[model samples]
Target: MSVTAPRGFRAAGVAAGIKADGARDVAVVINDGPSRAAAAVFTRNRVKAAPVLWSEQVAKGGRVRAVLLNSGGANACTGAPGFADAHTTAERTADALGDSAAEILVCSTGLIGERLPMPELLAGVDTSVAAAARDGGLDAADAIRTTDSVAKISFRRGDGYTVGGMAKGAGMLAPALATMLAVVTTDADLTAEQCDRLLRAATAASFDRIDADGCLSTNDTVVLMASGASGTTPDEEAFAALLAEVCDDLSRQMIADAEGATKSIAIEVVRAADEDDALEAARAVARNNLFKCAMYGEDPNWGRVLAAVGTTSAAFEPDQIDVAINGVWVCRKGGVGEDRSRVDLTGRDVTVTVDLSAGGASATVWTTDLTNEYVHENSAYSS
Candidate 1:
């Protein structure tokens, strides 16, 4: 299927001096007529961004016409002033779009604990709103990235409609919600509840399954909006399926772009007592740095996999476990079976499989390899 964005949405990105790098620091995405509905999920971190708190409250009503996003200032931990800045930003965009401030969602990313430069932000908002065009979606994607080497965007066309998204994150990413920021737009006809349901289910399997360093962020947010401009309404099941695919695509992109990551790892758990047990086992393996480093070095260390699983709640007998690395059966019946020297990690993708010999449930999680560069980059992040 050809990937494309829906009509009725225009995007623009402009630099307002928020970043010392002078990159695009603000973005605006506007939904024209037939403003569909919106739903969102944010970080569980108690130290939330002002924009996150503001958007969460606005999203409660399910109607949004625009989103104003800024990069290079997290707008977190600034107390009332930070919230005021978020409200001011939203109001600026709303005024430009002729929409109510409550109808404009806000998102921000970058170094935490600093106040936003309001003058520059307001200037960027004006420029973005004026530059908005249907083809400008990619620019908006670029504007929201920080420390990300490349902008992550995905679009899928299905049954006379389209779903498009842009995501940004390079560190502090883990399960429950990666340290990511995303804005997804669709022309499909869906109710607010339907959008929320689809997003939650999709995230559970995709974003919620990736763990870079087992560290969650204080600013992870995913906002999905439906513009209903396609004029073709899909059944609930079809919409859900399409939404899930879009989310999965973005999730994979996030993993592939992990900070200093050398390889993308897929951890699969099978023959578990239940789905939850399978997921628990998969997550444990995904978060293990030793397991990830072994994969990065092309070492078939099945013991790390076994150790990870043993730390989880998944019911399993050590003697009955089976494990594979890159389709090579390195361990069988809880013991080394094949020669570990045969495994290869010279490629950018790797897969590890584990079987519990318990029941029939299964799950898959995505992750990335740990490297010295990851440690170096994060150690001096504040400097």
Candidate 2:
């Protein structure tokens, strides 16, 4: 259980035959609650998906009852008919739950530039609604996956309230949002303003720091719904901290299951002029595909790391930076320092630490290595 791990939440994932092989493609989550307060963060992509446009409105209103997600057609670039399908899905979900359609949010993922099969989608909605149960969290998590090899689920328990969430994305993973789709439910009492503020802050430190493939998804959506069933209101800072923890756990899960990734890398930028510089330097290295390939090969290539660090706007002296791979100082003062052969990357975890020596600020970004499997998996993703 993940999405339904929190009180007052029920979810279901159903096989609607949307996928050719009959994998579960539809999911439903209902906040059977005394509070319908909600908030969401969506993809910053200008050419948005139909479901994203629709859900943006729902999220803005700050109240929600049910969430319906399908993972077979992204419903992006499909224009008017796609929007119609998303609206219809929300309407059906609202009707099934005996709630207003305006309170229903819909999400879809898969191949872009294609229209969803409206008939099967609507039918799946019915099945998902009828199948919704308190124990269906895992099923819903499984249903939302596209190229992901494993389901991503996370939970954080507070004094009286608990947070539960599930995410799906293996490719098109980058900052400013990714192909990532996530749903979080909680039993805590929170106003819409608090929910919205917390979601942005939590994601900034979690999902925003991951760059698995460096490609943004038009269908990306992360939603948080509070049912207020716990009957307790924890401190705002406490709730926010727990939310960030849960988001970080889910982010790690996403990286571990990233498509065709042979290893996970943590790019840490330390001693920067400020947090912004640290973030910039870290992200620049994380998105360096050449460096990612080197990690896949277990090669200690410090030159690639320095080249990446130099591209960032972060304040740093080019000749003063130090680079470490897996705790081995491969490059010191922008020159070779340690023996390269001593740094072993045979394991799945790799860490690239860049010491700017510019200030005291630090930031960390997560990324995955590029591999043959990654190329192969994405080449046929739409098939």
Candidate 3:
């Protein structure tokens, strides 16, 4: 189950003819709720898609009844016409739901620098709205994919509420979000402000920590909608924890399915000067192509890790840093400790521990190994 696993939500996915292969390309999720408080986060990239621009305004209103998403064309870099198309999309969805356009959010993903086929997309919206059902969560998740080999969905049950979510991404995953569109639904009663605060915190600890390829997407979006249908006012802290877990689960799924990736790596930075320092150090290594390539070759190259860390401004001593791979301390105090060959990286999962030895604060960043398949897949991505 995905977003509709939560109470007061209905979702549907339909073949929209937007993708040449005729895959399900459009999805709609509606909150048929007693409360429609919503919060969302978008890509930090300066070059945002038209849907993102429109959705940001919708998020500001803090109330959303429906979200319309399409995966086939990214209405980015298309100027005013693209913006108009996005507006029209929201208006059409709003008309179908009998809600104001301001209460509808739109998200788009796929090849950038192109316009969407509005006729097919809007028709798909209408069809999905008519087909929306409580059990259509899986279908909704399946519709929002481009390079993803499988749909990503996660759910968690709380004391008296449930949080469910779906995401789509297989490449261009980076900090401040990824090349993804995610929708999360919760039945706990929450104010719009609470939704906003909790969503941001949850994303920061989850989506914001993953850097699959260090390439930010213009259409990245994550939305949390509270229906208050459970009729349970959950403890804020507990709800936040549950929401974070779902987001983290979806994040890991994205990494596992990253385009052409063979190894999913977790770079854990411990004993940093602060949480920010830990994040900086970890992200530096995660984004380093050299380190990613080393992982792909099943080589425990601690030198590559040290080199990446040296590029960061995080509080750390060059000679005091310690690096470990798969429980083997390959480098201790910035020098050789355990034999590098003793560390195994042949598995699909790898862990790199970096001891900053600065403080107690720690953070982890998820990433994937660089591979020849990744290069080949991206070379013809726009074709």
TM-score of each: 0.95, 0.97, 0.98
Q: Which ten residues in a row have the lowest lDDT in candidate 1?
A: 170-179
In the predicted model 1, the residue pairs found to clash are none
RMSD of 3: 1.9
lDDT of 2 at 142: 92
TM-score of 1: 0.95
Ranked candidates, highest TM-score first: 3, 2, 1
What is the descending lDDT order?
3, 2, 1
Q: Provide the lowest-lDDT 10-residue window in model 3.
A: 170-179
C-alpha RMSD by candidate, in order: 2.4, 2.0, 1.9
Q: Candidate 3's residue-wise lDDT over 45-131, tens digit each?
A: 999999999999999989999999998888888899999999999999999998899999999987777789989999998999999
| Number of the predicted model whose lDDT against the real structure is largest | 3
- Per-residue lDDT, model 1, residue 54, is 95
- True lDDT of residue 35, candidate 2: 91
Top of the candidates by TM-score:
3
